[model samples]
Target chain A: MHETAIAKAILDRITDRLNNLHHASNATAVEVRVGEFRNVDPESLSFAFDSLKKEYPTCIACALNLELIETRALCKDGRHEYKASADNAYRCPNCGSAIGTLVSGKELDITKIVVSQNK
Target chain B: MHGPTELHILERLLEDNEQLASHNQEHFDELGLLAVNLMSAPGAGKTSLIKSTAKLMPADCPIAVIEGDMVGELDVERLREDNIPAYQISTGRACHLDAQMVAQLLHTTKLPDCKILFLENVGNLVCPAEFPLGEHLRIVLLSITEGDDKPIKYPVIFHNCDAVIFTKSDLLPFCKFSLEKAKDAISSLNPAVEFFVVSTISGDGLPQWRNWIVEKANKKISHLHIGL
Candidate 1:
């Protein structure tokens, strides 16, 4: 349910922000970033967004885009630097120690919004 | 209207959920609740521990549980049967539970009276550790049957946990489980994490576990009252 909760939360916030902006007649597009480590299913999120859109007709034309970020692991083995591969299982290549910390992938954010209003 | 589209970047899509999670944490702090998010592989005895803990808690101390699963409400049903207030959050196709889901469940359940809340996250080692549910404590359970290399294999989970509960301890004698090695591996990853060896079936080491939880809960509650 990671994507379900995340998608709902994103859409709910978008609606709130749009409503607060007093753009009752305008549609908007929102982009969100989800890290590869977050293990979110983008397709499921799209499905959820479609369902939510039905309730908020004003957001019928709004577009939701997901940007997936991939992260890797970094560790040191006896003064030697090493990085793990892109695979799910992360471990030190040299020492085989799985204590390597995440270098990038675990991030989820709503970066920007595009609102379409009549001029 | 025919038009060429412009591309825009909207980051922090989960900001709203994060805000709600922050609010939930504030509420938890106010009540002095030590919310523990328990994550593990399937059949790791998370629910069993919940039952034992609930039974051991003092009558005045209120405890509640939120069970996350893919489909059935079996955990919820079992908890309710034991006279505990439990809620089920179905993720459908989702693999793990996040802070927003916990926040929504907290809002819908209206369980302000509880001093301690247990979120039994969906049985998964990888994804659950990635999302912060604003829990004061994160306990990862490992059974003797799961093999001793779990910590070395799943260091991320151990690194994020505040404590580790080695359940099904009674099977240790029969299985090739090495408690010492397991502790060493977990310690190598998270030296500060406390450990509790318990068996729900044998009722071993449960009282000490209960006491530890109660003491922490009481301390948190006192701190909250002082802040007020």
Candidate 2:
């Protein structure tokens, strides 16, 4: 539902960056890392990105690259690391102890944009 | 022909919103206020919870509100009728209240003197969870009418909030809302979250909710004092 806004934000930021480049005319792809802990739906985000890209002539050929990160948990006792799931109550799988720390899985960032000036 | 180049943007997607949120956080800290972001799906009794809270809070306590909706100033007007200091943010088309809109509100609205600020976000279990609007605590409401599978389906929102309030408790007997099932789903997602079962109509469990807010506010103030 909010993917359109996200797409706009991404394109706007890249567009701003594009303005500063010497001869960059368009982008081929934009890469983003999304985490399992985030509520974003990558499919919806991609669709929104595709739909909104038409407004920016510089991003007409742009494609969205979504890399999803899995949610992981570290045990408080420093003995275990496992995929975090609601089934385990986010606890360490080996010891059944408390969650020590969240390792990754909460990322929502754009890593790189593939841009070019070539026809 | 120039080769395609990779611009390593490596930036947070919501950087602009986050920066403004930080500014709002600093502003709140300077004013010795605790901002709570209250969220829920449509018809979750968020407004009724506020009205009940107003009745339960001590008369001496200073509280203000920022109401967000897709469009309309109706809620702000309703709050003003009760003499509460309030501001309204009509999102127009936005589904959630982002930090930039709140920053805009901060710039335009002169909130009255208050120790606690309740930001009633636009009704959504999904989008609002993605944006952190400079709040000390995030509370999400779930009415009994909504069903028990919400936490399991929307784990991101369920797992992120500090607490969850089960509203419309008075109608529990008439509905199929299984509290145990709901709790099971919630505990599986977030074991440490505080839970409150409330009914604004009967005033079954509002004191605890009201007290929780006060305790959080006081704790925030003490933290600032310690920082000084």
Candidate 3:
């Protein structure tokens, strides 16, 4: 699955960031935001991350925090804001518009990282 | 006593892929090749459509392809048999092709100087949408045999694509697939997405589809010339 690749990327980023820090010993936790439209399963991602992190000493025991964002869209009319879901076929529920500006749900970002400092 | 400190490093997880995708795009731009990424689920007739489109393309405007599959070069062999320059990338374990995979191929191989380069992505619909492979145009195919509810179920892929090709029209009468419902669902997610209905056996929409591709490729060339 692509989640394994994503997990590797996350671990690589974490390790890179840790190495750049002056006194950082290892990463303790990492926070990431994923959107609904990304097709990433949180549980699968977590499992992959946990499995892969063992290879990287810098983030071996790091906890991964995943925040899944909802898919929301703004109608072309610029007034109707609706949750894009299967029920409405991702169209604007109120305006019945086919095209809508996506407000969220495409995000796949690492927001924060916590690291242990070398005393 | 220094404890664990929290650092805010707000960055995209796919930053590497995105950067490489842009680099690949620049390379294609320099070559004046219209890079088209064809993505769809398994067995949606991507290789067949490519073969049909290659046949329809003008003699002056040639086409090359980079086929992605989980294993084997069956599609690549098929394309090569038709005298189409094709390369195969067997993505072991990975469900989708990333920009890096394409970048490596570009580095290793020298493709024929064609007006268009078609990248037929691996057969999965879900993960391929997440990775951008430096394509100027992205198209998704939906075979009628796959049912009309696919667009609604996989909205992300449908929404991000430039167009959708409804394939296997020859079997439409036998299947319960409704073109109207499929179009409605996809247009709801992406109103700008163009639709093409076709069957490789009958060549129903091959001409129109070929024309659209040629027009787009010419437009790309002209647009670059104008910029210069």
Candidate 4:
């Protein structure tokens, strides 16, 4: 539901990074990384970006490429690491202690922006 | 005529919101307010919990509420009727209240001197999890009527919450809500989250909940001095 807000933020970020490209030039692509625990529907985010990009002349031709990251968890013993789930998430499979530390699963970031350098 | 240049940048998608959230927190700190973000699905007894808490809390513990909704000011009106200091932020299009909206509320409304500030986010289990509004604590309410599978379905919201409150506990007998299952599902996702089963009408867990709020308030006050 708030994907539009995210998209706008990403566009603003890229615009700021572009640094005064006075003449209009199309954005080639924008790469984003969406983690499993982010609760973002990639399709919806892409749809939002597409709709928003059309309104901006610089991003009209831009393509949004989203890479989904899987949820990963580590146990207390540090010997056990696996994908996170509704069950047995924190429990160390070997030691049987509940201390599953989440390493990565909440990453929602714009990794890179590809744009035509002809400004 | 130049080729495409790939500018490597690893930045959070909601970085702007997070920055504003920090700014909001600084303002809250300046005012000595412990802001708590209240979240849940629509009709998950958020308003009831707020009303009941306000009624049962220790009289001297001043509390304020920031109501967020897609539209309308009904919640603010309700709080006013109860003589509770409250403000409202309506995100007409957005499903959830982000930090910027709450910051806007802070700028416009004169919040009373409060130990605790409850920011009741727009009822949502999904989007609200993605946006933080500079809260000292985050509590998500789930009613028995919503079923126990909510934790399984909305893991993000459940995982991010500092506490999980099962509201409308009186309906536990009539509904198929399994408290144990809900707890198990949530614990696997987040072991540290405190769970409370309460029925505002019955006042079953109000005492414990009230105590928790006071403790949090005290902690925040002490932390303010000690810099935590």
Candidate 5:
């Protein structure tokens, strides 16, 4: 549901980058890291990107690379780190503590973008 | 004849949103206002809570509300009926209210002068949690009728909140909801979150809820003065 908004943001950011280039170039791919806690579905994001990219000619042929990250947290005890999943009740396996300091799960960042020089 | 170039840009996709949220926060802070974001599932009694709490707030600390919904201004109308200054943001298809939507409202409309502002986010547990609307406090409402497993099922919303209000406490006898189970689940997700069991109909637990808000608002004002 919110994927459409994210898709638009991605397209807007990439298009801005594309527009800033001195030489003419076509965007080839965009890589984004999505975290588990973001409530974003990969398939839905892909569908939204594909459907919306048509409006932006520079991104018409661009590919989206979504790196889905699992939720990982450090325990309050500062001794244990664990992956949060349904099985573990999203708590630390050793201390049974909730996310004290989140290590990686909330990232929704665009790490890389590939573009081909046009002759 | 160069090949594809890989640009290294490790940037948050929602950076624009984060910036706008800060801007909105600055606006609120500058006005000596404590903005609170209220979120919950559809029909979880967000509006009801606001109506009840507005009456409880002191005369000096006036209250303003910004109601967000996918469509319609019925909630805003309800608040206005009580002579409260309220604005409605009708988000056509979006499930959540982003900082941009709020910024647009702030830029276009003039908000009433008030010490406390309540942003009733679009009634959605999932998407609303992802978008911060420049609020000083985030509160989630879970009615007993919604069942006790909601905190576990929708952990993101429950985890990100500063407080959780168990609404519709009057219906507790009729439903199979376990208050202890719900509190335990939420505590696991958020250890420091404050909890309140409020029944707007019966006027139960309203004093505690009102006191919590007043204390937080006072703290915000104090922080503002000391430039914390």
Candidate 6:
């Protein structure tokens, strides 16, 4: 039940965005921003989308583009920085204080959707 | 018509989940409750600790528990037998518990009027740490039988936790467990996390652990009253 709920939520978000796209554009692309802190499996999401597309034939031609946004942890020292890797360990290069606040990276959103209507 | 065009699909998938978690946090704070997210590997004595803690809680202080498991309501049944208000969250196959699941349970379950609510996360160290459930405190349990390397093997969970509880300390003599090594390893990952070593069976070190919890809970309540 939990797995299906998660799968359905992802698919619903993807398809909702797809259906809301401007029909005038004939582009087959969509950009999804996944936050590093969300900790969702990209492969599982892709698999869910692939299976979801089987029900909606129009989505088969659409290309799903994933953009990973890395989460940054603020260090205790006077250094402001963001992480660029999957590693959640963001330490201050100056003073070795683990007191770092999360700057950004827990974003899971569909930024935009492009559909082809000319074909 | 084959030219490249950019479409920005910026939408936060977890926004709803986060909002719900925040709501749960607010509810807990309003009730003067300290909600704890208990995480550990299976057979790490999470339920045992709950039973012990519940027994030690003050008579006037109401205690409730939210038990998360992949299947079965055995833990819930045990809690019920103990006369504690308990709710079971069976995730079926999910390895971890998320905020949304807890939020749904809070809405559906007939929780007890309590000052402290313990959410025993699905017995896993990995995924539960990934999602925040708006808990005031996150406590990770490590049994001596599980070995000392667990702190290193699962650093993220330890790194994020507010405290660590070393359970099954009574079995230390029977098992090859190194307390100093585990403490050193955990300190390496999270130097600020509080540590409590307790053996439920022998009642050794349980008082200190219980006092720490009571102190923390009292501080939380005081802070709430002060609008902190």
Model 4 DockQ class: medium
The DockQ of predicted model 5 stands at: 0.66
How does candidate 4 fare on TM-score? 0.93
Cα lDDT of candidate 1 equals 0.73
* lDDT of each residue in B111-225, candidate 5, tens digit only: 8889889999998888888888788888999999999999889988888878899999999999999999999888877887899999999999999999989988878832211
How far residue B117's Cα lies from its native spot in candidate 2, in Å, is 1.0
Q: What are the runs in model 1 whose C-alpha is more than 4 Å off?
A: A1-105, A108-119, B1-10, B221-228
Candidates ranked, most accurate by lDDT first: 3, 5, 2, 4, 1, 6
lDDT of 2 by residue, A27-58 (tens): 88999998887778888999999999999999
The Cα local distance difference test for each model comes to 0.73, 0.83, 0.89, 0.82, 0.88, 0.72
* 10 residues in a row with least lDDT, candidate 5 chain B: B219-228
TM-score of each: 0.68, 0.91, 0.96, 0.93, 0.95, 0.79
Give each prediction's DockQ, rounded to 2 decimals.
0.25, 0.57, 0.67, 0.62, 0.66, 0.32
- Model 2, B154-204: lDDT tens digits are 877877777899999999999999999888677655667789999998998
Worst 10 residues of 2 chain B by lDDT: B219-228
Q: Count backbone clashes in candidate 3.
A: 0
Clash-forming residue pairs, model 3: none
Better of 1 and 5 by DockQ: 5
For model 3, residues A1-119, the per-residue Cα lDDT tens digits are: 89999999999999888888887588899999999888899999999999999999888879999999998888876558888899877777777886568888888899999888867
Better of 2 and 3 by TM-score: 3
lDDT (Cα, tens digit) per residue for candidate 3, span B29-55: 888899998999999999999999999
Error of 3 at B213 (Å): 0.5
Write the residue-wise lDDT of candidate 1 on B1-228 in tens digits.
323233344445555545665677786787667787899999899999999888888987879888999889999999999999998999777777777778777677677578789989999877687666777778899999999988766666786677899999999999999999888777655556789999999999899988887877777632211100
Backbone collision count in every prediction?
13, 0, 0, 0, 0, 12
Give the clashing residue pairs of candidate 4, or none.
none
Docking class of 5: medium
Tens-digit per-residue lDDT, B44-85, candidate 6: 998989888888888766689989999999999988888988
